[model samples]
Target: MSAAETTTAKVPPTRPSTAQGAGGGTGGAGKPAVRRRAGGGAALPWTLLAPCLLVLLLVLGYPLARLVALSFQKFGQPQLWGFQEPESVGFANFTKILGDGEFWAVVVRTIVFAGGAVILTMVLGMLTALLLQRVSGWVKTLINIALVASWGMPIIVATAIFKWLFDTDYGVLNWLLSRLPGVDMVGHNWFASGPQGLAVIMLLVVWGAVPFVVITLSAGLTQVPKELEEAARLDGAGSWGVFRYVTLPVLKPIIVMLTTLSVIWDMGVFPQVFVMRNGHPEAEFQLLTTYSYDKAFVVNDYGGGSAIALVTVVLLLGVVAVYMRQMLKIGEVE
Candidate 1:
């Protein structure tokens, strides 16, 4: 061969671009790297999530399992202390609770209380959030500070404050009300009637609940497009109309989330009622949580209490599932 032919022969042949392989094309050299990267990307999430999943399994999983098991068995002091083996009562406990009129009453009361509290919280929260938007910068800052302060207050402390405020004779509320013309409110026992007392507790719940809702809504409100609101205004939309058409659609998801959360929190209200009533809620004031406690610890009917608690969990789960469905529908609509 000539010198030029020899030089050409010595040069290596050009290979296909590895970009094709990286993009899952014909180039084989980059395929492994792509697979490796994709595999790592998929695995990273699970690896990061492993600790949380394990913690939940350890913390919540075992207790939940135990609760279910206890609900199915005739577990009481005897069984708890190992003096007698827990008898398998199957669905008897559930049957008893379901048949009991008192249980049904408590369930109804819980639902009503929760519904009312959630409604009040969401309204007050949304109003507060809107107010925050309209306020000056310093006023907004002060409002945010107040919201955070209230939100950070311990539930027990708040409950105690509420209890004192509603106290019969020496309460600040009665004192203030007595100051009004023709109002003889010197001594008013807020806890005399169940409805009256629950109303107070509901106020307390709403008070505590509103701060978080307000903060969440405030954050969500920031995401609302100013241009949209301006456009709405230019189109002859009144304040209510603008809010209903432009603001509400942007805020629907946040409102839904807050409402759902408020429902869960209000439904599970225990400390406020329990503490306000001095750990002994009256028959009329009894919620599902208190009732379950009464049956298990007070009445020593562990199986029945477990069943009640399980039923409550089921009810809450059902409510949450409904919320989830609504959220899914919202997602589809959006």
Candidate 2:
């Protein structure tokens, strides 16, 4: 208890570090809990998605791998039935498909058909969505019911209904058109010409596609700021100007997504064309899907058919890339 001892005695001893004490004398013990939480958070989404991924791999991945393999081999009836071993032909199938004038024609026709269908679908959908925004509540509800009903209709049933509507001999569409003064649509063969036939099919495609687009656009519309729209109008923006300057920028992402999906769906149109043409699509009526189908089943050129399908997949991947780029650009703008 001298001077130094007296000073030390008066001073209180420091307690052990609270962090270490709380962590049971191990300062870094809590780190593992944080790391585990981080890891678990990262893994949770993938764990949730694993079931869907497994199903897709089983359902779509196997067929896609088989298609890729078949495209490089001679896989006709003989090989298909095990009557003969398949011969590997390297790039022969791809070369033949790329060299074919008919294949190129089908490619161009498909692009045009899909382009038209997407354009019409977007225009009609946007107009309908805007109309919904203006209509009374009950009217809007009725329109929603109609849109959902059409969207829920099975593709086969809808195709059959369209077929009857455009039937050559007995169709309500023709009867209605004939009622127009100086118009002769009775007994008109709508499927006689390829473009005309494709146009009709395109209408059917648009009809099926528009409801989803309308619903999506309408939902997106609700997210747009009414204050921003009113501010623009007060600044002397007209209807078109307000939409162009305010509304369009806000909805650009949704519009890009809808357009891309519509393109993909329209390009892969098979059931509509196949069922409409009575399962035997004419040469003029051939899109890529139908052409590949005819090549595989009708002509028994499975390799060529697979090659065409793979090319189509490449084109669709390119479209998806465009959509991704657009979304990224929109994000940057925001």
Candidate 3:
């Protein structure tokens, strides 16, 4: 061997190529391109979600925009049926609805009715769900079947049936109550009094609503860890204490979701109340939804009606926002 060659270490000419392959097959300049690709891949899920957002914008956004514009414009019989253009009245419609004492009364009435329904539905649903969890076999099946049947019954149809049940002269309820000792419900005319009729309507709403709450609560209960519940019980907690402390914290999100939906549904309750107030459409029996319909369709005051609707939307948004905040706070705490 030549002395100069033998004195030097051997070097592979292709070592740089192998080094590049080992380091992710990307040279320094190619890294930015790779990173760009990774960024695109990360955004694929959101890209897929775009269609849902677009559909919502088209459906909800378009209607909401029209409603806001309509609230600012007085579109009465002339604009609606006479081919006349609507005139912009700015806040006048809002002021009119807001300044009316009767409108305020209706708003309060709707709020109270919805609140009552939500509370009753939640309490009853929770109790029913707890009971169902303990029951088994045919008893559970019968209970589930009954609740499902109630849920499947259409509100409009149920309202009609209830009207007959509470009828003044020949109602089965009146007859049954009259037969009871010291009870004088016969010929009582349940709908004759405004409060009495409203109370009945609230009960009907709760009856229709509870099944959904029951199903939701039951599903949440299934997700609760049995071991944790047993541990809580072994630690000397009673049923209520364990439920309040252990099960509830875990089910908080579901409870919030169910309550929000119930509140929103009850707030916009119409068919049940409308059917109850069918024959006698008195001002005292008006809910916010019914009152808006009355003003727009019956009285031909579209702008005033739209203003009331906007107010209702605002209240609904406020309630949903509160629930969203609670959910976020709970998530953070967890």
Point to the candidate with the largest lDDT: 2
Query: All predictions: root-mean-square deviation over Cα?
Result: 4.1, 3.6, 4.0
Model 2 has how many clashing residue pairs?
Answer: 0
TM-score, candidate 1, is: 0.91
- lDDT, candidate 3, 1-334, per-residue tens: 8877765646545456754655565356567877899999999988999999999999999999998999999899999987899999999999998999999999899988899999999999999998999988698789888999999998888898888888899888999998889999878888777788888898899999999899889888999999999999999999898999999998889989999999999999988877788734688789999999888888999998899999999999999899989999988998
Lowest lDDT 10-mer window, candidate 1? 20-29
Model 3 quality (TM-score) = 0.89
Tens digits of per-residue lDDT, candidate 2, 12-78, equal 9898897766667455678788889999999999999999999999999999999999999999999
Off by over 4 Å in 3: 1-34
lDDT of each: 0.91, 0.95, 0.89
lDDT of 1 by residue, 47-137 (tens): 9999999999999999888889989989889987989999999999999989999999999999999999999999899998898888899
Best of the two (2, 3) by lDDT: 2
User: Which window of 10 residues has the lowest lDDT sum in candidate 3?
Assistant: 18-27
Error of 3 at 97 (Å): 1.1
- What does the lDDT come to for candidate 2? 0.95
Per-model TM-score versus the true fold? 0.91, 0.92, 0.89
